[model samples]
Target: MSSPQRSMIAKVDSALTRCLCVLIVWLISASIWLLGLLSLSDLTMRIFAYGEGWSDVSWAELSFMVIFAVLLWRHTYYCRYFAIGIWKGMGRLLAFQGTLACMGLVIAVFTVDVEQHLGASVGLLETGADPALELGELGFILLALYLAAPTSVAKRLSHSPVSNVESAHTTAEKEFTV
Candidate 1:
């Protein structure tokens, strides 16, 4: 390829790589928010099923709503191109919370009798409970965490102001000395 053509191709390739990386991260964060929604639903259901005179929604629903709302707001604010500075720590925290939520869901699935509450004669086995929802939730959780954690590409993107400043200082000194 000609030099101009090669340069264009390289630029396109880098742009595509950056876009793909960002999309992957955004999807992970969105999945975490979705799982939080599902968890809220389950908690609400449990409360209504067991609580006496529970005509109104309980604190669990409200809390979950607040949590998800805050998450959405944060995701919207931080997922933008200009907001990449805080992504490293934010991604880790989000991944940790998502993993914990998934574990809690697993424990709930195994411990809580879905059949007893819903009158659906479905156990974990036998003409059993449809595990799709649980499986999908787990899949989302795991995949999201995997994407959020630092990989080689992510490490390459990390920026350090101290290192940058030191390098700039050395360059300035060299220019002044010359």
Candidate 2:
């Protein structure tokens, strides 16, 4: 038999070629657009109002919704051509997205003249002259950023290819042939 070093399984994971990353982002985006966003928003509202409670629904409907959500997210990555910037640390994407979300929340609170009571979100943002923003807005902003992070990473990976040597097996396990 050919050495395990030469086995197809060795490269199967790496063979992903960065496209899978793109695929994941698209999947998430689509999920949010079709099913996740609405369902998640509803879920958030419900939880805030009533906390965790059991829901009785047909299995078929649940299954259909899940499948539809997945498919929608998968397809969305293809819809938009996003230019992801330099590839940095693993968690950088999430961090950047989150920062943007926070900034957006601050901007919204300042621009829109509205009265909102701060329950838990007060700790995160100090209120003096800055109009207080609600927790719901913060939650939605977070959700949006969360969805966009993966796609951003994928765009970066695809645009900037890693050197073959850098990608070569660096796993702990070593192999030997007889």
Candidate 3:
């Protein structure tokens, strides 16, 4: 291929890669947000159930859910940087959220009766709340975690010539200053 053709191809490839990365990040974020919303809805239903009027603990739980929603919203906003090939701690944020979700879902699967706890409320699966649905959600969380892992991010960055160039420039500066 000619030089201009190769350069054009490279630019197109880079754009496509960026778009794919952004799409994946958006999908992961949206999934997690949906899960959180469902949980919040279920909790609200339980709190308002007959003979289960809101209490101090119920208020605390609701507050925590609100905080979680806010944090997730912020993280979603920060995801815009990923389109420009900036990590900006978004990977760490994703890993942390994914790990927490995995642990919470595992515990819920083992200890809580999914149908009983959810109480006719919709769940992540949309069919009904069940251990199998929780497990499916767990699988997704694990996949997100794997994708956001530091090693995985590093590997992806290493393949980018811009990252390599930046690293080399920084190394050269460090060597000259020392």
Give me the runs in candidate 2 sitting further than 4 Å from their true place: 1-48, 52-93, 112-178
Span of 10 residues, lowest total lDDT, candidate 2: 83-92
Candidate 1 residue lDDT tens string, 1-178: 6654468888999999999999998887888756655554564454355566545545644454465556545544544543444655465546565666877667667645766677775444454434465444434544443444433333346668877866766766968877
Q: Give lDDT per model, in order.
A: 0.57, 0.45, 0.54
lDDT score of residue 34 within candidate 1: 62
Pairs with backbone N, CA or C atoms under 3 Å apart (clashes), candidate 2: 26-73, 26-77, 27-73, 27-74, 30-72, 30-73, 31-73
Runs of candidate 1 exceeding 4 Å displacement: 1-5, 54-97, 100-122, 125-163, 166-178
Best by TM-score: 1
Root-mean-square deviation of every model: 10.7, 17.5, 11.2
lDDT of 3 by residue, 3-96 (tens): 5446888899999999999999898876765554454445445435455555533443465456556655555544553442335455455445
Q: What is the TM-score of each candidate against the true structure?
A: 0.37, 0.25, 0.33
Candidate 3 Cα errors over 4 Å, as ranges = 1-6, 51-99, 106-178
